[model samples]
Target: MDRKSVVNQILSLLVSAAILAAGTFVFLTLIRKPEQEASANPKPKPPVVRTVPVLEHDGRLDIVVDGIVTPYREIEVAAEVAGKVVYKNEACNGGRFVTKGTLLIRIDPRDYELQAKRLTSQLEQAGANLNELDVEVKNTEELIKLAKDQLDIERKEVNRLAGLIQERIVTDSAMDKAKQAELTSRNSLVRLQNELQLMKTRKTRLRSAKELVATDLELAELSVARTEITAAVDGVVVQDLAEQDSYVQKGSPLFTLEDTSAVEVKCRLRMEELHWLWRQAGSQRSAQAVAADYQIPQTPVTVTYELTGQDGVRYEWQGVLSRYDGLGLDEVTRTVPCRVVVPDPRAVNLVGADAIARPSGAPPALVRGMFVSIQLHIDQPDPLFLVPEPAVQPGKAVWVVRDGVLALVKPLTLIELIERQTEAGDLESHWLVESKTSALTPGDRVVVPPFGVLSAGMAVEEDGTP
Candidate 1:
């Protein structure tokens, strides 16, 4: 209680109080220290990046194109001879089917028949004239023979008279009369010979006229045959402009027929797409190689169309690569036209070759102008890797995930780039990549797009991966 005792006690109490304060501060710091330490040096959360598997398989690329179907053959039948239509076939109307050589229309044959009859009559008359002239020629030759005989007899008599005169047994007047008789017979023979020659010339001219008339008759018969119009091909009548009792002129269009036994699809493809197709179809290893060889081989193709049924099934038909159509790059779309021919759409089966079971409902045939899809196989035996379009980055690089780490890799071989315009008109490009690098292999995961602030060697977590 004294001043010194009080100071020592106060100092002890102060020291004790300071120790207690220090102990309380240590207790509070220990209690709250965990949160601050955790805030300062925290374990990082891996960035969640979307990823897809890298699939390696046989490079059977399926190329799709939109096109319209058309008939393989279309023909326009024209009238070859002018006449009134006397008859028309039942199949001559629009939308009716007709076989080859089926009679479609018949023009009036009376006129052509009369013309042929007239020519035949002329030919008969010419022939008759020739026969009459030949007979006259024969008769005139007989008369000429008689006249020659008479001249010979008269000459002999003149010679006998001359002998008698030499013997002084006959008068000079008798000898002169015999010579005059021989001269008269000789002149009559010359006149008969001239008449026979004229008859022969007439006969020759008549025969020539007969030949000309016969040719005219043949032509008239041909015209009569042409009056019966017939179908030239097995097809469907798309348009029929001829009717019974209708007068038609030569070269007038009678009907338009569409050969529906087969159909053609007219489609367009890009240059790159064409290259892929050439690679599939040609014997060369690459499209460039095929082009260098200057040969475009015909390849197999498949055509499909979605039916109107409720099953959402597609019907397919087999076809072959027909021709390049050579419709060079379009100015508007920069695509080249191609043509495919399905030999017989009616022969197509309802179910596809790869189908496990038969399809339901009746199959529909390929109609003209029906919108269809075409599939062409562009498979290469070599292995190829498919990375989803989302996983592809700029510069033709891809974000590959290895052991949960992101890597940017550039493949060595880029076989092709398929670009398709979406319904919104935006071009979406998908790549077909090939690589010999051991770093990239099948079953590896690739980071998809929108990977927030991703870099090489960055740790990533695949969304939805167990």
Candidate 2:
């Protein structure tokens, strides 16, 4: 009975195992069919990328740099003549504006006037002495002439006496006396000639003395005028060291006037920025001229100061690239220091998106110590294509998409990297590159961000491409 029962149980187990194996085989076949179909019709997806159109740039590059405002001219007014300040104009106070030639201070002119009067008296005395010498010289010349005539007459008389003696009409003693008189008259004429020479020498001394007195008088008069200190330019007094009743010595500082008519912006430029500027200047000037001077071109620039707490509101003033501030690059910054001069510091334009929305008032003047942004409007020598900064890879290459394929442009002639403020007041950077390379065109699409394993001639699909 046990054997029969064991045989039946084994048969049932075998049947169950066969059924389970069949079900497993069926499940494998179903999965394998779909896998083989997929392997036979393979569809590889291409890498997706973002693209931006390469736009043609206007032949102008704006190099924006940070700068600080400075006065075009700072004049330290010093006392030319030492005296007590008897009067000081109200405009001579600190922070006051003064027009050119405005009286700023008056040193005690009474002492200068007295000194001038003494010099004048000395000059008059010298003039009188010269006149007297002239009169004396004239008298001496007349006396010499009269003495010569007398000598001639005495000689004639001696000759007449000699002739009478020869004719027995006169004695030998009378002839001798006439000869002696002629000798005496000759001595008198020689004395008068010596006196005339002495008078001429005296006149020369008197003339020299007169000239010296005249010079002294001129200097004295100048000192008198200098006692009244006047403003040398239309400027604002930033310092006032001299006050009424204060005594000042020669060369003492009285005030400091900053020229308000114009202002200078002190800025620094990198080597690349200077290269573009120099290249543009070289095109307009002769090679010889450039070599001789080698100066920075006076390119027009806009000096802008963003208003605090005012979104997108900037005060802009027109200026020119005046000159290099120093002879070489700055030691700490390794940049060339330059200056931009605004002819009118008060002439300001409210610029920006929110400029029109802001309240109207007097725009602040471009004074010293104001941090500003200077935009140098430089004209490029050639046309360039603008590409987004992210599109430019390291080593100056850009990925261009054409016909659903990616092409790598290597060794692009990058002119500059510029930043512009968008309408949303956000700054975006772009690369300005020369279009002469032929790798990039105005209408070409450039791959931007979210880059994958990029290779030349790789199949790529634009994100928005159909």
Candidate 3:
């Protein structure tokens, strides 16, 4: 009984072991089948990216620059003579216009007048003294002539007496006395000549004194005239330092006036922008002429500004490029300055005497210190392709989508870097490129976002219907 039972158990155990081993082999084969299938035929991975079309167009470029309006001419009026200010024109306060030669200030002229009068009196006295000396000289000259005649008479008498003594008709003592009288007469004549010479010298001194007094009188009169300071130019006073009873020293500033007939705007230009302008101007003028003096051409410019009172409305003015204003390149922005002038900012039209008319709905005056933007129109009419900066790859190449595939292209000419602002106030820089290659043209899509390590001939799926 024991041998039969052991044989049946052993057969059953062998069958169970065979079933378990077959199940394990089937599970392992099933797990390896997926791996082998994956290795044999793999699914392709398509690069997903958004695309934008390249824009090619010929458009007028308006070069824009930020600037501030300033006065065309500024002057500081100064006093030439020291005096107490007695009067000033109403316009001297500020923001008031005055014509040329209009009196702006008047200093006290009493002191100057009194000085002039004193000089005149001194001159008159000098002339009187000169006249008296002239009369005295004439009298002295007559006296000298009389003395000479008397001396001649005394000499004759002395000679006759000596002859008589020699002939024994007179004594030696008498001849000696006659000779002494002749000597005294000669001395008197010499004294008269010296007195005449002294009178002539006195007259010369008096005339010189008169001349000096006359010059002083002229200077005093000039001082009186200078007391009444007048406007040198037709302008509005922007500042006034002199007022009634305000004493000013010589050469002291009295007022600061600006000619408001014209306004100038000082603006800065980037180096690239300046280069573009100079090149355009050089095309018209030879390179030699342009290089000698790179003055900005006298091109028409439109200035736009919004006043604090005007609100959102923009006012525009026409101006011409006048000159370069800055000394050199700015330290911070590396920009040069250019000035543009707008004449007749007032737009005042004279109809008749005491009558004036102005342009209807004209904008406010372009006063000093007004911030503005200047637009210069360039006459370059060439078609250029614009590519977003995001699609621009290194080496002046761009990633373009052609037939839903990636293509790398290096443009022939990259014109400029155009910076514009988005609707959300975000600034965007775009590359203006020109591609002569037929591989790219207008309406060709370019991959923009989701851009990463990509190469030419790479396959990409256009995320949208674009």
Candidate 4:
């Protein structure tokens, strides 16, 4: 072929290659990038905002309290007499029952018996001595009477002899001798009387000594009797130390006595509860408060039981107020002691799980002896300012919307309750103050859905409209 025709073919091939490269570049740069961007990017979801309506009340306050129940008159019996334990009944440790005077234990009585016998012989000897002394006293009294009679006669004789001497009817020596004889006889009689009196006084002292010996014998008998241990009360023996051949010291714990036929629990009520109890007492109402202890009306601790419930909820039985610690205010929760006693759970039938309790406004169930748990209650009032927990933050802080702006603030008063009550003497009366103006004021429309970052005192679109 000719050289010019071959060159024309080459030029046509070059033009075709240029057009293909340019078309490929344009498609890759514009169409693929737009498609990739549209596929990767996505629209985000709206933010969720928790809010609550404002409430108000003539707010009397209430509070929750924690307490427990314990048996009354619990005592651990100790041995009062020291001895070797020899005998005991099966009712020793647990499930032991004995009536008054029931023998609980026995010590080796041989030694005490010997002592008692010896005391008995001594007492018999003392009694004989006392009887002999009584006879001697009677003899002494008779002798004193004789002596007085003899003295009177001798004095008369002496007087006659002196008169004879004065008249010179007899010799002076004879008269003198008669007088002297009378005097001597009188002196002898006086000495006999004194001896008798001394014997009588000695007999009285001997009788008194015998009486003392008798008392000693009685005491010895009593000591011997105490060696046989016996029960003083009728109850179940929760503890037992009396056993075979065990040495026990005086006043050592021997047994625990319990009467389970009736049981009681101890509890405390709030100040409000004490007020109710006092009123009950004043009214001369024999009506037993549900677990009433009349004595200790107020204490921070409470022991209580529910007396009634609805729909298969078992009611707690009523009981008289057995005791009270006294009424007073507590600094921590400001609640008074209210103790409601009922029949022991072991003694009575129980109702349901709903009967379990939590303190006012506390959602968590009660665990006995817990520390730092909330116990406050908002009393019954009209138009309550109830709000969800989420709306309020710690330190009672909440968000407010004003003029389309958000603000954070601490509330002046905030009352929370898991279960609210309106009793006759509750804090909440007819009047109530209700508001949500925490950090914001009225007439401020808040942005329902916040856009971007949220902060205190930040500007927001009114009704989210802009």
Off by over 4 Å in 1: 1-53, 121-214, 285-297, 351-364, 379-383, 394-396, 402-405, 411-445, 448-452, 459-466
| Residue 96 CA displacement from its true place in model 1, Å | 1.2
| Candidate 4 local lDDT, 183-267, one digit each (tens) | 8777777877787778777767877777777777777677678777776665567667567789888788777776543444434
lDDT (Cα) of model 2: 0.87
* Clashing residue pair totals per candidate (backbone < 3 A): 0, 0, 0, 35
> Can you tell me which runs of candidate 3 are displaced by over 4 Å?
1-63, 78-86, 138-193, 196-201, 241-254, 274-302, 306-326, 341-343, 347-361, 375-466
- The residue-level lDDT of candidate 3 at 181 comes to 87
TM-score of each: 0.68, 0.85, 0.57, 0.54
Over 4 Å off in model 2, which ranges? 1-48, 162-169, 357-362, 413-416, 419-428, 436-438, 462-466
Per-residue lDDT over 1-466 for candidate 2, one digit per residue giving the tens place of the 0 to 100 score: 6999999999999999999999999999998998899889978888989888888886588888999998999999899999999999999999999999999899998887998899899989988988988898899889888998999899899878877898899988888889999999999999988888898888889899889888988888999999999998999999999889989999999999999999999999999899888878877887466443646778999999876678767888999998988688889989999999999998888887667743565356889999999999998777888888998889998899899998888888886788866668788888888787657777899898888788988998898722
lDDT of each: 0.80, 0.87, 0.79, 0.55
Q: After TM-score superposition, what is the CA distance of residue 257 in candidate 4 from its true location, in Å?
A: 1.9
Cα shift from native, residue 461, model 1 (Å): 7.8
In angstroms, the error of model 1 at 337 is 2.1
User: Which digits, one per residue and each the tens of the lDDT, describe model 1 over residues 213-279?
Assistant: 9999999999999999888888899999988999999999999999877999998888877776665
Off by over 4 Å in 4: 1-67, 95-99, 279-315, 326-466
Q: Which scores higher on lDDT, 1 or 4?
A: 1
